[model samples]
Target: MKRKIRVLVAKPGLDGHDRGAKVVARSLRDAGFEVIYTGIRQTPAMIAEAALQEDVDVVGLSVLSGAHMALVPKVKEALVAQGMDDVLVLVGGIIPNEDVPALNAIGVKGIFGPGTATQEIVDFIHKELAEPAA
Candidate 1:
């Protein structure tokens, strides 16, 4: 049997709207991935800490505050500090295209912007996880 991929869906910064995050979480759950959502108003530190505790295979960060450039690095750094360098980090929500490179450099390899299909996200995760480095 294939072990279900464990994923942590986190909302960072002051983004009060979590409808998108909730929908993503449910979609991932429906796709057979175990998902843990950190809810709204979570700091980068809290997100990383929860990721570590959950020992999740992936950390899907939903940031809409335009603070993604600032917060994403913090979460990645925290994960690295905890020796979780191998964990996959995915960013979803409103992100400027230019910021994708920076997030990519910080180990947030997957980026899903607005209007992306839920199945695409699921397929992307599966394909990425199958990669040698993931």
Candidate 2:
């Protein structure tokens, strides 16, 4: 049997705004996936630790402190340091288009911004994980 995808949705840095993260977590849950939400104000190391402990298939970070550049790379580095490079890293919330390429270059596969439909995020993850590995 194919196991359900486990996702860790986190709010990193000093961002207190959590409505978006909560909404997406609910949406993903409704879609029948397992979601672990880490609440708010998480550091990169804390998030990485949670992801490893939960053994999640994906880590979705919500950053609105304009620190996406600094935060995302740190999280990615922690994941790699923990030997969890296989986990897919995703980001969302007020990210500038210019930062998108850099985020991808640092190992984040999905970068959702404001106005991005939850369905799109859900669908993308589904399609991405469904592809056969070469």
Look at candidate 2 and tell me the lDDT of residue 60: 96
Candidate 1 per-residue C-alpha lDDT over 74-102 given as tens digits, one digit per residue, 9 for 90 to 100: 98888998999999999899999998887
As a TM-score, model 2 comes out at: 0.96
Best by lDDT: 2
Question: Scored by CA lDDT, what does every candidate get?
Answer: 0.90, 0.93
lDDT of 2 by residue, 54-133 (tens): 99998999999899998889999999999999998889999999988888888889999999999999998998788698
Scored against the true structure, residue 106 in model 1 reaches a CA lDDT of 73
Q: Which runs in model 1 stand beyond 4 Å of their true positions?
A: 131-134
Off by over 4 Å in 2: 131-134
- Model 1, position 71, has a per-residue lDDT of 88
